[model samples]
Target: MFNNSIPTFKFLSYRRLQAGSLCPMGCNEDEYLHHISNSCSKIKDVFGHLNNWGFAIISCHSFADRCSWLEKKSSFIINLFCSTIYLSWKNRCEMVFGKTGKSPLSITTEAIGIASSLVICNHQNSGQLVVNQQDLLYKSWHPPPPDWIKFNVDASLLCSYKGGVGGVCHDHRGRLLLAFGRSCVHWDIAHLELLAIKTINEVFKDWMLEYNGIIIEGDNINIIKLIHKKIKAGMEGMEYLSFTKNFNHVICNWVNRDSNKLADLCANYAILSSFD
Candidate 1:
């Protein structure tokens, strides 16, 4: 009965091996399931949220070990893990092979949908278990602010190893309000972040738009933390010090990779612009 109960075990095992063998984010030789699932920066954007939801992640040496642990859980929990594993693998594929990386939120939404269908099927076969309301609610809807704006920025170093910053600002309706990319002599990621912030200040300085709240979104969480006072020492601190000295307005908190999609697109545009 248990053997037929969870098809996800097999699916997860197969996918994990496939992903591990050709792990595209340039995982080091020491990287394994635990490293990829827990520590890798490339994937942290996806799995980091699980910690907030009270999911205990155990590092296992073998697929069988991971599956054995998963099978002992409630169907809801089992399905959640399965969905996450599947989606993480999917996102890796999109990022490496397709060059079309999606945000963690979008990937999570898809994972839940896929897992819910599987769970429903399993429940129906096993005499219809009661569905958890919280799970259903989480799956059914996502509430984004009505009038918030998101700005995405990316920086790429050109010929002299000097970088260029690109950014795009978009409203809640996904309308592009401003898009610009500029070349800079900045040499490192930290300097690039500072450049992005400086460019944003220039935009606001010119437009003088009276916004109730604003979100400066970027894929670089280190820069975000530096801006938000979460961390004290780092490249972000230097950038923050510079930004505070120049700009007076308070920028809202930093967001994850998933929430900063528009910024990535703008960054890519900025890179492309350098060639022209």
Candidate 2:
């Protein structure tokens, strides 16, 4: 319904509903995504609330620009923005259908509630509404938790001792805070991978006096699922997982390799270092 292609009354051009394209606010412009979202006299106040809250993308010139800008923000904040737009759209529909109307303030309040619910429900990994930017669709990585530092770690195993381990730590905005890489002897692949986690954990441990805690990520889901086990099958990782208590808190998560690309690149750098 948010896209321009929809046959809103204004776009349909049927003479009986000739007034359809015209905004009820009498903006004299065809009702489009831009009109309902950031313009139009009926529901523009929601944008003000969103902007004051530092969404940093409402000022963008177009729907596509705003979508790309929102890509860099946290999921909670993005849902907050989405809620505002949705509420505004609903209000517009109600008004047009001659139903009792809701003020923009009411809509904004509801949108904020929606955002709060998203956070409370832990919808951090919920799939996003895919919007096309121009002719193409694009998706990007997500940020870490609010006020928490994150570490992405990976290791490249080789039969040769040229095995490498590395990690990149970043803040909630995905800005690089620290990165480290080194050459290491190739043991079993799982053993070497656990060493990479240990190395990154050590980095966070050293910063224990500065930050509150850290969230560590890797692409190995099987081992991550087994990391907290007391059994011997998890021996390679359980040793390092037990070290979490040394910090304020430590969260271990498995990410797709795409999200872990920066750390994978760091690991490759270590492999090259072995030859140097």
| TM-scores, one per candidate | 0.38, 0.44
Clashes of each: 2, 2
- Candidate 1 residue lDDT tens string, 1-276: 224322222334465633344345665534445545545565565554444324455556665676788777766667766777667766775675667876664555445445545555455467544455223322221122445555566666666666668766654444345656676665587778757766876565334244434566665767776666632443354543343333334354555555544344345445544311
> Cα lDDT of all candidates, in order?
0.53, 0.63
Best by TM-score: 2
What does each candidate score in C-alpha RMSD? 14.8, 16.2
Best lDDT among the predictions, by candidate number: 2
